[model samples]
Target: MMIRSALAGLALALTFLMTAAPVSAQTVRVGIVIPQSGQFKLLGDHVRQAFEVWNAGNPGVFSDVVEGDDGCTEQSGKDAAAAMAEAGVDIVVGFLCTETLAAALPLLTAEGIPVMTLTVRADIIAEEAARLGWKFFRLAPRAGSEADIAADAIFRLWADQPFALIEDGAISGRELVEAIRIQLENRGLKPTFVDNYRPGQATQPSLMRRLKSAGVSRVFVGGERADLAVIAYEADYQSVPLKFMGGDALNAPEGENPIPEGTIAVLAAAATSGPEDQAARDAFAGHGLIAEGLRIPAYAAAEIIGAAATRMTYGETSLQDLLGQTTFSTALGPVTFEPDGERREPGFVLAILEDGSFRRLSIEDTAALAGDSN
Candidate 1:
């Protein structure tokens, strides 16, 4: 009788072990770095939300997230990287700002942790990440794409109409406006008026008067949304026919139309909502979050990372090979990045704000553009 009892106990223990074994491997470990607090917290929140949305419907088991808040600062970024490195996570994702990402690179690379960044910094591939041979990937298009997208839209709308370019005294603003200038010059048209606007000052009366007096009908703005809004408002207040065109920075202008009703924009957003996106958008709305901008890009990045993670778990491939060789089907569409981490597809879009939302204008086919991409 004692012998029989011993055998039964062993059977029960084996059954328990079998059940718990699969459960223990269900959640993969991953480290997430984002600005959970500070100036960029809203964008960070959207990143987290996008990951959660992707996790809900993806085929992988799940990931146990170890979060690090970079707060869009260099010190915070290092601290966040140190925390994640200490956690012994297999991979690190996020780092949505240049300041934080730049600071954290050495730390992450020292530990041989793969990083998938959501921020668009061209210098990463061209200079730092490439030189170091670090396993870092940028999931967004290069900043230069904003210029190409904006120029394409402007060329379509006013190839004949003389336009003016204005910028604030910021590096990003200068780059944006200079892109417009280069594109215009390439097409044999020089801007009639080129000037700079003060970023935060409430009054642009003198600047507005100058543009109007110059008889400029269209103005391309490369500055803060609030500043452009003030300019647009002043133009309307004085009955000036100046219309503003710009990149996605214009989307942040609060309250109402910051530019004229027919103003055009080159949006950074790659994903346009479709039937497949309804569930995610609805889920986001249910939680009082808007799934836009960084959200969609984050979702696409998570999809790529999740798929690679799953394969890595199965020992089928490594993250480096998967990232370099594969094309991911994202909510935006099929995406493949060049060796230099530039996205190898049509990455920019043109849209006009209508009835409080961006209504995209039909342009060249993305597939054709991708085919012709250098």
Candidate 2:
């Protein structure tokens, strides 16, 4: 009877171990939602590669990747969200389009899944996330941040100087310039002149003439890179000696007119080549990939998820709670999210375009540069 009882206890212990093996060894499933079949495929491919690079370094975490075709459309977004929920993904990442994110949020929210969007930076979505209680995290800069940063930088550098505010219709230029104008005005600062300019013109000589007439030495133009290029060129052509500043739109591809040297803009630091990005850049180079555009942020998103997942597994905190409260180190430097899921650190910087590239400058540097330009 004693021998039989001991054998029975051993058998029960074996049964328990077998039952828990699969549960303990289960790997995380990460849902990648991006446009796999559309005009944005190239961009999506970049994001996908970043995840692959990240996974190569950390093998056990998120061994399975559920690819979702966002298609950059509303219906596809819904389909992707549903599929991810059905597949039981631990978290979702790589949403580049506003349409895709807007459609997926409600469904993912219902499923209690957290999402870290690499793009889709419209301010409305952030506000909606807070209002609707969606577990959404934004890794990209907010849409109106350009205006806010520009206003603050301009106020610091050119508050006492004669400066004008101008914008075009391209890329929501009106809204950005107006926001900057209002912010500066609220700070008790007013522009010397303000007007709307027609974009895509071959020559902005007339605009330059008007700016010259205003007796303003500095101008902040909320317009496209191409338009700003022309305006700056025309200013140089007319010998106006006017120093030009712009919002983040200046970071876009150069137009027929090369962006003039010494042009200042408020923009984010380059995702690659910084001290913080060295490891990521080396990893990308090893895999024959270049870190550009949406790739670095996507990589950072994966790291955030992996770290949070590990912490959640070892602690009593939920992934959502951990993400909201903890500051994670990434290739973009230290990233912290507000409870609403907006990234708080690594804000926009003041940069000067020189010899065809933008070099970030300090506020003190910007002040000195602005004074010299005038």
Candidate 3:
């Protein structure tokens, strides 16, 4: 009778252990809701690579990646959010395009999942936060902020030279160009010319002629990669002496044709082979991924999730408390959020295309530039 009783107790203990094993291994799962296959696929791929690198260094922190095709559309974003919620992911870390993010915001907020967005449009983030609550945060600089950084660099470089402003009619592009113009105007320098162009139309010979006629020594262009590249190529082909300046979209990696030489691209501060950055890069390389824009932000998002999970008393985490208290020291820089979930401090670097590769240019006190609306 005693032996039989002991056997029964051992069986009960084994059953409990078996049940708890899976729960223990389920550390923290984050859903990366970005377009895996679409126009924004490149951006999505970079975000994934960055997350993988973070996961590799800190194993068991991020359990899985749930892909969602948010394709910069409202309907698609809704579908993506539904899929992520169904997967029971703890957090979500991406939305490269603004429209998609706007659509996904309410759905993710309702699910009580923290979303760290990489989209640069300020209005989308502000509107979503105002409509929702503190469920969303942005990692990238705002469109106006980025444009102002580029403008500051240009103004400093060619204070005496006449400049022209060219804008593509996208929401972000238009805002950036206007901001740049405002900054120039504040410095008592008006743009020699301002023109709007539709994205992805054949090279406008008349527009190019006007730019050349303006005789501006330097020009600031706000447009997508293809549009900007076309303008640069046309300017080069025409042998215009004008140097061009634009945003990071121009720095995007390409095959064969690239942004013409004698052009400067202002971009987010990039890592240059430090121990932390190299380790992160190596981890991604192991997975056949290359880190690019918003890549560091993705990795930082994972780290933030892990830290929040660790802080939970009973190992039962809530997105609100986790994000509210977390401060991530990422490869990019120290990341802490404001009440509205925007970065407390934003920074950018001016990079020049040197020998077919983007190289960072040193700028002092980027915070001052951030504050300088002029």
Candidate 4:
């Protein structure tokens, strides 16, 4: 009888251990894909640091991190993806180059792993994702989103007023201006003047003269800071009263020709501004690094990945479903992914140049300015 009781007790204990093992021993592996070597290594380092800082703050969130270097090349990306799949990571994040990411998607998808890219903003990625059925998510806005945001802001503020669309003839500027023009036209609007001006000139007096003759009171300049400065300078020189707006390039570092006061800019808001981003910013600052560039976005990616992993581990939900169905609270702000894995709303804001820096424009303030313009 004593032997029988002992055997029964041992069997009960073993059963309990077997039943609870999965719950207690579950581990989530996260794969990090970035250019670990090459010219882009500095960017990869920043991303890795971001993940480290996040992990330190939230211990035990990720059981293990598998690192793979994309090398910012097609072959390297394929190798990296294969390694991540072989390691059986739950999800892979932190791609920088479009070339690398585009090359790696097929392999990662075949392994049934989701990807959240920190910096690859090429629109083709999203389009390809839709067509190819890739499980992809993007944290950065698409490249053309700059023009879309700029055009929307202009249409809101200066649509009623006489406005002109001008470019510097560079591919970046030309594409931006052309896209803006198309967006505005689709909205049943047209520019009062349209032209391309030669960039890098000492003065834009001729451009200013033509703008004045066309009665363009507002102009969207798709060009560099120096060219815009010269345009503003010549506008003042030739007594052409014009209010200028430009894409994010307007927020570039001040050169010899400083960005004029009152110039409107559609720029990405600086990280760590509000309370939502404060903790991550503090984390970066603790490591003696500023939360900027790819750093903050990578931090935001960490937040999303951690949350998704936690949910998928406990609940009866897959990582891809969690990513697509949920709205993640990130350092950058609330991030919601669309069904197609693109960011639902791009985080671009209208700002004004004041005191050599860009200050975010409030909605009320922007509306009031538009009213004044009209």
Candidate 5:
């Protein structure tokens, strides 16, 4: 009885709560499986707002949608996908967190729903998808993409400085640091120190001491921003003039700007740009969800799905095959996935925190370095 009632609730929600009026014929039933609640609730709001913009386009080929919140938790992720499957969605998208999509994959596979998740777990599409014979597409950068861009930016900004690499001992962090280290070594340059430290420790003065002893003036950190900030504080106490840099984790919310000014980070998602960008942001804000961070990517996801819907041949067209065959034009420009379902175009830019805000560092005309531009 409980399960039946739950299905009825989900069905009603999908049928009515989706939009104010009934969608026209040939509407695509999309299941948006993202965290609508939990620690990642803000990301949920951004995605919802972006989807609403996509929904506003007339007879927008996508509808009958159901939403599920994994709260960035595993069990919730599986349950959410299962619930959406029961609600009769044809496709699933928007798994922002890694664990969320991973937990939901088996259920989605069993239901024969193809998922195009918005995450950076390249291994899923790179290895697991083929191994398990599950159709999963990743709309974000592969894990290695982060390191690739970071290395390029580092070389552009401080090619001659003595540098160090640090990680938090987590798989993600370790992989990121090692990727950069290898790329640097390939260029015949090596980092001054490669260090791994436990996360959430009270202090890391000892690590700071070691780095200072090595005459390391530039750092590439592959872990939590809080830890980076802690490193900055300890460096200051040790009177070591150093610049701290890292991947996307540098901008992660950690209560406040823990790292000192001039610290840099590389992020995959860029800010919305131009008139089209403003229109999306306006539409996103109009929906009551504050737009930021992941909003552009969310909008890009909507555009990709909507474009794919245009090519769907109701009875005969295979969605999974079409996805691999077509190129999607997104807010981030044209997006085409590699065979492993990773985005084909990958790059990173340098951004430094200045005056309480992060700004892009243009290395185009950098006069402080060698002419390594290609």
Candidate 6:
């Protein structure tokens, strides 16, 4: 009878141990929703590569990647958000364009899942945060900032030169042009011309003629990859002798090499493999991923999520609590969020085409460019 009682007690203890042992901390699944197939495909590829590298470093952290075909469209974004919510993703990252992000914002915020957005449009993220609180965090700079940077770079490079502004109707493009216009006006300078063009138009011959007729020596353009390529190619074809300046979209990995000569682009500095970005790079490389610009934000997003998860007492932590009061060192720089969820970092860089490759231009600062052309 005694032996039987001891056996029963041992069995009970074993059962309790089995039940309480933490189950290897089930995979922290992250869902990436972006345009896997569409006009923004190259940007999507960059984001995907960054996530892949980060995931490779930390094996088994991601259970799976749920592809959201948000082709920068409202319908696609809504569908993708619903699918991700239905699939029960712990976190969702990547909405590169503003339109898609706007579409999915309501759904994702309502579900209470934290989203790390790579879209650069400030207004969309700001408006969404105003409506939804800390559920959305942006990793990219605002359109106004990019435009200001571009204006400063151009003014410094070619002081007292008549310039023109062109855009391709992207939200980033329109806002950037406006910002550049504001900067030019602040310096008592005015653009020779300002106009918007439809995307993928065969040639901007008429616009090119107007720019040349206005005797514009410098031009600032705000557009995505294809638009930049088209404008550059058209300018070359039209023999427009103006120097071209652009925003971050022109720095895209896919379209970098094709930019015509005499074109300078302002872009986010690529995160280099140095002491600062090394550990995170290693973490991402361990997963067979190459951490690049914009992608670094994705890895940082994962790190943020992981750190927050570690601090939670089992299921007690909420996404809001985790994101509301957390900071992490990212490849871009130290990332801390305001109540509005915008990253507080001075993160843009100006790159000029030197011998067919884009290289960073050394500018003192945006504000210091008044009356000086570097």
Maximum-TM-score candidate: 2
Backbone clash pairs for candidate 6 read 53-284, 53-289, 56-286, 56-287, 57-286, 57-287, 156-373, 156-374
Lowest lDDT 10-residue stretch of candidate 2: 19-28
> How many clashes would you count in candidate 6?
8
lDDT of 2 by residue, 1-374 (tens): 12234588797777777767643223468999888876889878888898899999988888698888878878988999999999998789977888889999999999999888887768899899999999999888777777888898788778878999998965588888889999999999999999889988989978888999999988898888888888888988888877788877787877688877778887765432467778888889999988888778888888887887666643356778888989998887788999788888635667888788887775677667657645
For residues 1-374, what per-residue lDDT tens digits would candidate 4 score against the true structure? 02234588797777777777665223468999877777888888888889999998888878988899978878888988999999989889876888789988888999998888887777889999999999899888777888889989888888889999999999889999999999999999999999999999998878888999999899999999889998998988888888889987776678887767888887765421655688888899998998876788888888988887777655567778888999999888899999888998776667887788777787787978888887
TM-score of each: 0.80, 0.89, 0.75, 0.88, 0.79, 0.69
Best by lDDT: 4
Of the pair 2 and 6, which is ahead by lDDT? 2
TM-score attained by model 6: 0.69
| Each prediction's whole-model lDDT (CA) | 0.72, 0.82, 0.70, 0.84, 0.73, 0.70
Off by over 4 Å in 6: 1-28, 35-49, 59-79, 86-88, 96-100, 120-122, 132-134, 155-159, 168-174, 192-215, 223-241, 252-262, 270-295, 310-318, 363-374
**Runs off by more than 4 Å, candidate 2:** 1-27, 270-272, 370-374
79 Cα displacement, candidate 6 (Å): 4.5
Candidate 1: give its CA RMSD in angstroms: 6.3
Please state the error at residue 116 of candidate 2 in Å: 1.3
Clashes by residue pair, model 2: none
Q: Identify the runs in model 3 with alpha carbons over 4 angstroms from their true place.
A: 1-26, 36-49, 63-72, 96-99, 120-122, 169-171, 197-205, 224-240, 253-262, 269-276, 293-295, 315-319, 363-374
Count of backbone clashes, every candidate in sequence: 0, 0, 0, 0, 0, 8
Worst-scoring 10-residue span by lDDT in model 3: 365-374
The residue-level lDDT of candidate 6 at 336 comes to 74
Q: Tens digits of per-residue lDDT for model 3 on 150-189? A: 7777677766677788888887678888888888788887
Give the CA lDDT, 0 to 100, for residue 219 in model 4: 90
Return whichever of 4 and 6 wins on lDDT.
4
Lowest-lDDT window of 10 residues in candidate 1? 365-374
The digit string of per-residue lDDT tens for model 6 on 1-374 reads 02234588797777778787774344556788877776778768777777676666666656787777767778887888898898888778887777778778788888877777876556556766777664787766655566667777666666667777888887767878988888878997777789888877766777777777888867787887666666767777887766678877776655432666546777775533334567777766676666765567666666666665555555665656666677766666666766787766645777666676676654443334333443
